[model samples]
Target: MNEDLTHLTREELIAEVVKLRKGIRAHRDSTMHELCWHHPQLWNLLPEKTIPEIAVPAWPQFIRGCLRYRESLDTQLPDAPRVKKEFNDPDSPSNI
Candidate 1:
């Protein structure tokens, strides 16, 4: 019987996961780095922290999001007419 897995099935994979998690908990002191990997505080955009340690590029990501939004804009509305509006300035009509 494998000790790591709570259930009896697939013991080897579970052991690997448990080992990895234990290592992270025991030796990793960089929780903020992990958090910042997925969540940018925006304060890190400054000169001291212009680029994050991770390979993610901010501008390219922003552009990709814009492109996706633009593509979704052209999509036809439903019979009830689902209106797409720019919430940034609610008063103005949305192009999408």
Candidate 2:
């Protein structure tokens, strides 16, 4: 992506950045939903205004820090556990 970006003119890069920012903002709701699913309590602590005011600015740095920490650990993290749902039981409405 960086190599591709290098080919873009300054105006094109600015336009791409604007488009990417808008795309990120548009997906914010889904991102928040995923965050709530993983950590409901932490999600609740993040005020609505904090996203635009703080999270956006801090996100890149935070992610970089996380990546550096993960690299330092020198261990592969296990995959997240999956929850199975029984949607087709004999007594379920769909079976009925």
Candidate 3:
């Protein structure tokens, strides 16, 4: 699959995200669970607010693969440090 992520317009980006969500759902159905389960990190690839819907049905192996792909992205964000921190401050949005 191609991973070229050009700057998409708002509508196009939303459409892309919707399509990806569909694909993730479909993938959850088509493959065995282990394909996504091995790596616990895959859950982090998705938006924190909406991840459960997309990930709940997916196999652990597939989730692991998804996480591997997410981490392997060309410009992915850094993983958080060992300690967990709250991010409810208005000034610092979670996206950053």
Listed in order, each prediction's TM-score against the native is: 0.22, 0.30, 0.27
lDDT of 3 at 94: 38
Per-residue CA lDDT of candidate 3, range 32-93, in tens? 22333443344544434343434353588766977777566434535532222233455543
**What is candidate 2's CA lDDT for residue 38?**
34
Question: What is the C-alpha lDDT profile of model 2 across 34-86, one tens digit per residue?
Answer: 43233333433322424333343288887797677556445543443333423
Whole-structure CA lDDT of model 2: 0.50
Instruction: Report the poorest 10 consecutive residues by lDDT, candidate 1.
Output: 30-39
lDDT against the true structure, per candidate, is 0.49, 0.50, 0.51
Runs in model 3 deviating more than 4 A are 1-6, 31-96
What is the Cα-based TM-score of model 2? 0.30
Number of clashes in model 2? Answer: 0
Candidate 1 error regions (>4 Å):
1-56, 69-84, 94-96
RMSD of each: 13.8, 17.5, 14.4
